[model samples]
Structures are given as C-alpha cells and as structure tokens.
Target: MDTETVILGGGISGIAANYFLGKDKAAIIYEQRDSMGGLCDNFSIGAFKFDTGIHLSFTSFKEVREVFDMTPYYTYSPEPMNYYKGLWLKQPIQNNLFPLTPEEKVKAVKDYIYKPVQADDFENYKCWLYSKYGKYITEHFFLPYTEKYWCERAENMETSWIGNRLYLPEIDEVLYGAMSSATPNRYYAQEMRYPKEGGYKAFLKPMLSKVNINLNKRAVKLDSSHKLVEFEDGSKVYYENLISSLPLPALIKIMKDVPSAVKEASENLSATSLILISIGLNVPQDESKSIWFYIYDKDFLPARAYYPGLKSKSNIPSHQSSLQFEIYYSRSKPLSMRKEALAEHLIRVIEKLKLANRKDVLFVDIKNIPYANVIFDKKLYFNRNLVRQYLNNLGIQSIGRFGEWDYLWSDQSFMSGKKAAEKLLNM
Candidate 1:
C-alpha cells in the first residue's frame, strides 16, 4: 500500500491531523489497536464503565470547544480535594490550609511570610518548590506528593513542566484559608466537562467521521531512507510524508538504522506507566461528593483516584458507584508488587480510608497503560530535543502528548494534530 501521507497511531492527534488535512488530502491513519481514542478510551465491566484515568475537558480554546461541543456533556465546577494525615483539604493545599492543625498552620504561614528570597536560577524542581512555597508547605505537602505522583524525587526533576499547574497564592489567601474550612474551589480549571452518555472518547466522534483510519495495522519496522513502513503482518506502505503519534522511544526503536546518539537519547527518555484499578460498588456513595482527591500518605500505593460515578450518572448502574485509582510507576521506581497483589492492597487501603467497604465491592478490574505521562526529569530537554530533531530531519512529524513528550490535556493534544497538519499542508 502507498499513500501521499501516512499518520501512525489513530488517537485524537492522528484523527485531528487527518481532519485538518481534509478528506481531499487522502491522509491515512494506521492504528495498532482495534479501537481508537488512545488514552481517552474507556473500558466497561458489565454495566460499570470507566475511563483510562481521570479525563475532564476544561479547555478555553475556541477550536477545541467547537469540536468537543458536538457531544452532550455535563459541565461542573471542579471541587478536587487532597488527603493529608487523615484531613481532607481542598485542592491546591497552599491556598487551602484550613484543615491543618493550629501549630502546623502557624508554621506554614510563618514559613511563607519569611520564605527565602527567589533565586536567580532554580537547580531543580525542589529548589523551585522551596523558593515559591516555603519550607513548611513544600516539605509537608508538595515534596512528598511530587515523589508519590512522579515516582521520582522533586530534587531530580526539572521545573519547566510546572507552568501555572501549581498555584502560587498570596499570603493573605493562605491565611484566610487557614482560618476557616469554608473556602471556594481554587483548582486551576474553573469548570470541567464530561460526556453524559458515552465515555470521554465520545468528544472525538465528530472528528473521527472526517478521517480515514485502518485498525490493527501495527508498524514493526520503518525504513526512513526509502520512506517505507513495514507492519507485523508483512505488509508494506511507502509514504511521501509521515506523521507519527507513537511514543518517542517506541518510534525510535522501529526505525531502521538510527544514529547511536539519537538511539541513546530515546533510551534516556522516561515516562510513567499507570496501573488503573477500577472498583464497582453495590451501593450508592454520597459521602465524598468531590470529583477526585490526591493521596499524599505514603501508605497508599495509588497517587490519586477519581470517582467515575460522579463524572457521569450513566457510568454506573442504578444507585451504584465506582472509583478509579491511578498508580504510577517508572523505570527508576518500578512496581514493588504485581498487579494482582497491588489491586488487593488498594482495596484494603480504600476500605481503611472508608471510601468503600469490602463487602459492598461488586467487582475489581485492572488496566495497564504503558505511556501514561512524560517524565520531565533533568535530562528531558536535551534528550527529547535530540530525538525530535533527528525525526524532524528525516521529514517525520511527531505530535500529541507522547510524541511531543510533554504534559498536555485533551484539547492540547487535538490542537497538536491540527498544527502538524497545517505545517504539512503549507509545505
């Protein structure tokens, strides 16, 4: 098979690229999976349905809204919480310190009021955290939570990815939150939206109609020199222009005769793999009305968890609820226990946390996502740039979160594909 343009991976990025390229361009997308949507995809257990993880659309972009608004969705004010020492504090703990003990609150406020001067340059994420959040806040919350979520210490990670993701509050805001527990939601996203019926992938249904995708076409080898791709089923396709949304490392491995430096850089690129634990309940849950909460206690294996039932009523059966826990692991901090053992551990922890009871648990399911999020460690900039530059020179366009190797939401990923298609069309 041959085509003018070939897009590898039929995720939102690939779909968006082809959509923007127009049907007349005759771009073809090859996806390894039977279905599309990639990370935005969801799985079902009987009547219970859950997304790969927590996926909410809160984009302010007009282009993204125009596409996603095609589907029926429920808009909500984000009310995310954080768990610390058995106290439930609002999200952005720095801005909501009301749940802390009086002594702890005093120390946190004092540290913030007399925090160290901002440095000319931050050595690592740890340095940036201290310079911004002060000692007490960083040590008690941000530092520990960073290690749990990223599976790496803050000191070893880069600060480039922290753009407005973490809230930097005024001293008065912190003081007010410390005085009373009745504080408004301070999450970065003012409001979030989820599909009322279908899963998160439903938002892309409109775009999917405009693109051509071939499923179960896994590319095993690519001869960039000849502009040809060889799949596992012994099929070959020569392309004039290629756009790939494959993980950088996986893409590098399949390419024929890559430079040693580029190969080394690809090997150095690190990302977190997710073990998604989905639990269906026999009874309704109205206790924790919040969307999701971050787990700071090291005793809990999962970094965070969200209530899918809250996201949409159709996600569960009548009067039933469900929870999706996200446990992150990377090459450095590998999974300490097997998936089965980890699921059991998580169940027990959830029971102890009083989120659910063991008897009320209807069923438990596990899903492993290899490329959950890109790890922005100290070596990320140099290594990612090197590999991306090599691919660019080879006339390959890499888009989406994994392709670009950065933290991007759904809207950003969709826009990535559109931007790449535009670049190709202009050329």
Candidate 2:
C-alpha cells in the first residue's frame, strides 16, 4: 500500500482536504477521538442532541457554499442579541443600539461621529477594539468580556485576527441604529445555516464520507523531517506531505527536535478553554425571537446562550426544548466547585436574569474543550511568523484552527484544509 499524504486531526480541515485531493492521492487521516468533526461533533442523551459548540455555516466562498450544499439544512433568518451591561442590545450593535439607554446611545453616536484616536500601536485584541470603537464602548462590553472569554488580557494578544471577525459600523448606520426601532441588517447579524437532522455532525458526515479515516489513533510523535508520524499504538506511517490541525504547541512538542526559540515562540501562543453547559427545558423559548444572546455581566457565568431547538426541531427531544450556555475560562483555572454546583449557579443566573427557570429546565450537561481560541498578544506575530517559517523549512504544513494557531470558524478551517491539500498535491 502506498503511504500517501498524512492528514492529522479528523476535523473539518482534514475531511475537506481529502475531498479536494480526491481518491488517487491515498490520504490517511488520524484522529485522537472516537469520531471525526472535532469541535463540530454532536452528543446525544435520550432524545436531545447537543453540539460541541455553536456550529453555524456562513461564508463568502463559493466553494464553501458548494460544500454546504452537500447537506439539507436550515439557513435561519438572523435574529441575534447581545445581553451586555444589563441591556439586551440587538445584534450588529453598531446598527441596532435600541437596547442602550439614551445616554449610551448619545455617547456611542458621538464616539462614532468623532472616533477618538489611540496613542499606541496595536498590541492586543483590546487595544484593537479601542482603536476601532474607542475606550468607553470597549470598556463597557468588548474589553472585560473578551478578557473573560479568552482568559487573557487584551494586551497579551495580537490584533491581526480582528479582520472580518470585527464588523465596523458606518457613522450614519450607527446614528440610524440608535434612533430607529427597526433591527439592523439581518445578514450582518451573523445568520448561519445549520443542519436539521443530526445537527452539525450531519454537515461533517457527508464531507468525511470520501476520506479514509482512523479514529482514536493519536499521533504521539512526529518526525516531520523524514515525513513520518508515530501513533500511540506504536504504528508508523510515512508520507510525502503532512497536514496538521493539532494544536500548534502540541504539534511543536511532538517534532523530533525543535529549536529553543521555536519552542519558546510556541509557548507564547495561549488559548481559551470552553465549558459548554446544556440545559433541556420543559418550556419552549418565545417563538417570536431567535435565541442567541451575549452576556457581559460577571454575575452571568455564561458569556453567551442560545436555543438550538429554536433553530430546528432536531436539536431537542420530542415535546421538550434545549439551550446552551457558553462559559469561557482558561485551562489553568480550576473546574467549578463541582459539575452540579456549577449547573445550579448557571440555573440561578438564568432565573435571576429571567432568561430561564428551574421549572423550565429538565437536565444539564457540561462539556470542556480546551484551545477554543488563540490569544493574540503583543509578540503574537513575531512568534507565529517564526514558527511558520520554521515549519515551512521542515516541509510541514499546519492548517485549521489549532494547527495554524489562529482563530477561525469551521468555514475558515475548511478553506485552510482545501488550500493545504492543493499545495501538497502540487508539490
């Protein structure tokens, strides 16, 4: 058998690469888990199906759209809200400031009209936000909350990742959003297409069908110089090219001999871990609204909440409802007092905030996923470019979220995988 290109981590990137590379390439994908899709997988208990994270499909690429067409799914009309500073601000907050108080609206409009200049060159995500939205708005919402979410101060992060992800509002639009009662542009509200049957895993199922996959096989060691990987089971595989979606730090550590500077660079790239708590509820969410909500209050353990059931019936058990709360923390942080204790705390917040109640909630499930995001710090670019150059010299290609050490949604992961496969095939 030929030892073709080796793809590590059976997430969207790996499968998409295989799809683009075609069968003649003899691709082999090795994943540590029992399944593919990585963060996009779904978990089920009884009749309720919960996603690993909020996996939504929206991209500008025609190829991405083509891949999305592989599944029969539901594209929702955007209806997102931000629960920040005790206010239920509409999504695209720049274009829908109705939730803000008169004073906040006035301040935001004034800031938008005459945006203040920042003194320093961008160093972190927070600094970038200040340059874009000014100090007050960043302080009131993006700053502290983003710090909580990423588990790092903004100054510790790089700002290049802000492209496309941060939507900048025009001055006229900001004023209109503040004055008008109508919602902002629904498209810019972060609307997305979701699977109706097996949840996000459904989208992955078909994409992965064409690829050769081996699950529960972790690549414990890598000899990228010779194009070889050693699995945990003592098995070995050789390849002409390797595409990795594993966390950059872990990937670097696995290499046969990494330089001191490369190792140090990898160390500087920190990431946020996530605890996804799911609540099955007896009461259905208000049918009049979409369930996406962002929270900034420290009291609310969740940085965000959403009702997947509201997106599609497949998300919930028969005759019941479901919602997900996203609590962001660092891996170094201790797990909450206990799972039950944490669940109760979240439930209490929901009740106190009038988002949900004990009677409405039937069950709670918690899932912890490390490396949810790549913290962009001051030396982020220097470290990232150094690592990239080193990897390139070794003829190793890192793709996708963790592999690239960048923040990217599933679409970007797919795009990265496709590009990497093309590069490998051409080589």
Candidate 3:
C-alpha cells in the first residue's frame, strides 16, 4: 500500500493529525489495536464501564475547546482532594492544612511563616517544592505522593515539567481555604467536564467519524531510507512523509536502522508504566461526591482513584457505582505487587482509607499501560532530543506524550498532531 502520508498509531494525536490534514491530503492512520483512541479508550465489565484512566479534561483555549467540547456534558468545580495519612485532605495541602489536627496545623503554619530563602539554583523537584511550599507541606504531602506516583524521590527527579500540574497556593490564603471545605476551587482543572453518556472516549466521535483508519495492522519496521513502512503481516507501505504518535522507544526499535548513539539514547530514556485497577460497586454512592482524589501512601498501590459514576450515569448499572485507580511504576522502581494481587490490595486500602468498602464492590477489572506517564529526569532532555533530532532529519516527525517523550495532557497531545499536520503542509 502507498499513500502521501502514513500516520502511525491511532491515539488522539494521530486522529487529530488526520482530521486536520483533511481527506484530500491522501493521509491514513494505521493503528495496531482493533480500535482507535489509544489510552483514551474505554472498557466495560458487566453493566459498568470505565476509561483506561480518568479522562477528565478541561480546556479554555478555543482550538482545544473546538476539538473536545462535546455537549450534554457535565461540568464540575475542581476540589483539590488527596487521601493522606488515612484521612482526606483538600489538595495543595499548603492551602488545605485544616484537615490536619490543631498541632499539625500549627507546625505547618510556623514552618511556612519562617521558611528559609531558597537558593536560585535548585537541582531537583524536591528542593523546588520545599523552596516554594515550605518544609512542612513538602514533607507531609508532596514527598509521599511524589514517591508513590513517580516511584522516585522528588530529589532524584528533575524540575523540568511541574509548571501547571502543581498548583501552589499563597501563604496568607492557605489558612482560609484550609479552614473551610467550602473554599472555592483553586486547581486549574477548575471547570472539569465529562461526557453525559458512555465512557470518555465517546467524545472522540467527531474526529474519528470520517477518518480513514487501518486497524489491527502494526507498523513493525520503518525503512526510512526508501520512505517505506513494513508491518507485522509482511505488508509494505510507501509514504511521502511519516507522522508517528507511537511511543518514542517503540518507534526507535522498529526503524530499519539506527546509529549506535541514537539506539543508546533511546534505550536510556526513562518512563513510568501504569497498572490501572477499576472497581464496580452494587450500591449507589453520592455522599463522598468528588471526581478525582490522590492516594499519598506508599503501602497502597493506587496513586490516584476517580469516580467513573460522576463522569457519566451510563457508566454503571441502575444502582451501581465505580472507582478507577492508577498504580504507576517504572524501571527505576519496579512494581513489587503482582497484577493478580492488585485488586485485593485495592479493596483493603479503600476501606482503610474510608473511601469505600470491599463488600460494596461487585466487579473488578485491571489493565496495564506499558507507556503511561513519561518520567522527566535529568538525562531525559539530552537523550530524547538526540533521538528526535535524528528522526526529524529523516522527515519523520514524532509527536504526542509518549511520541515526544514528555508529560503531556490530552489538549497538548491533540495540539501536537495539529502542529505536525501544519509542519507537513508547510513542507
């Protein structure tokens, strides 16, 4: 098969690329999976349904909104929530210190008030957090949570990508928000929105509706010298330009040939893999009404859990509810718990944290995401750029979260595809 463009991977980035490139451009998307949507895909267990993870998206940009704003959708005020030390604390623990006892609160306040001047050149994420939020908040919440989610000490990781993800509250305003659960939403996902019907992937219908996609055909080899691609089925495809939203490591491996330096860099790149655990309950749960909450303890494998029921009513049975949990692990910190044992661990932790009871759970499902969140450590920039530059020189554009090897949200990945499409158009 031959085309003007052979788009690899069927994630939002690839779909958006095709959508923006237009039908007349002779472009087609080739996805290895039976369906498109990639990590944004949803699955079902009995009558209950859940996304790969919490696909809660909030966008204010017009272009991003244009791509994602599907109506009959529900919007929520962001509540900064975290499961901390066997209790629930509003997020940005600095601002929501009221969840702690009076003594702990006093310690937090004293630390913040007399916080030391931070050096201008902080090396790691830990130092940066301590410099900005004070010692108490960093040690109590940020440290434990960062270790749990990233599977690395905050000090070991670089501070390249925490700009918008971590919401820092003012010192004076901290006590006020802490004192009241009624404190207005302070996090950036302030106007959180989700589909009213099925799982979050339902919103992708617009982009997928008219795109020409070849599913179940894995692109195994990229013969870039001849501008050709060879799939697992022994089929060949020639393209004028190649746009890949596939994971960078996987992409590098499948290329017909790569230099020793590029191969070494690709192998050196670091990333976290996710073990997604989804639980379905027989009873209605409306009391603890929040969309997403973080799990701070290291004992519990779940770094975060969200209510799928809150996203859409159609996700569960008439009297049922569901919660989705994400346990992230990386090569630096291997997952000690076996996949078969995760659900049981989740049940015990949910009750221990008082989030829910084990008996209430009617169904349990788990999925593994090989390439989930990309870890931005000290060597990531040098290694990723090296591989990316080589591919760029050969007319292959790698885009998206895993493709570009960065921590990117849904909007950023979608924009990446649009940018790649424009780059091709300009060329």
- Per-residue lDDT tens digits for candidate 2, residues 75-166, read 87767778776667777666678778899888877766666667656655666777788655777777777766777777666676666656
As for lDDT, the candidate ahead, 2 or 3, is: 3
Using lDDT as the measure, the top candidate is 1
Per-model TM-score on C-alpha atoms: 0.98, 0.92, 0.96
Which portions of model 2 miss their true places by more than 4 Å? 118-124, 186-191, 331-337
Superposition TM-score, candidate 3 onto the true structure: 0.96
Per-prediction RMSD in angstroms?
1.1, 2.4, 1.5
Candidates in descending lDDT order:
1, 3, 2
Q: How much lDDT does each candidate structure score? A: 0.90, 0.79, 0.83
Please give the lDDT score at residue 117 for candidate 1: 81
Q: Rank the candidates by TM-score, best first.
A: 1, 3, 2
Pick by lDDT: 1 or 3, better one: 1
Candidate 3 segments exceeding 4 Å error: 178-180
Clashing pairs in 3: 80-91
Worst 10 residues of 2 by lDDT: 183-192
Per-residue lDDT tens digits of candidate 1, residues 175-205? Answer: 9999987877778889899999888988998
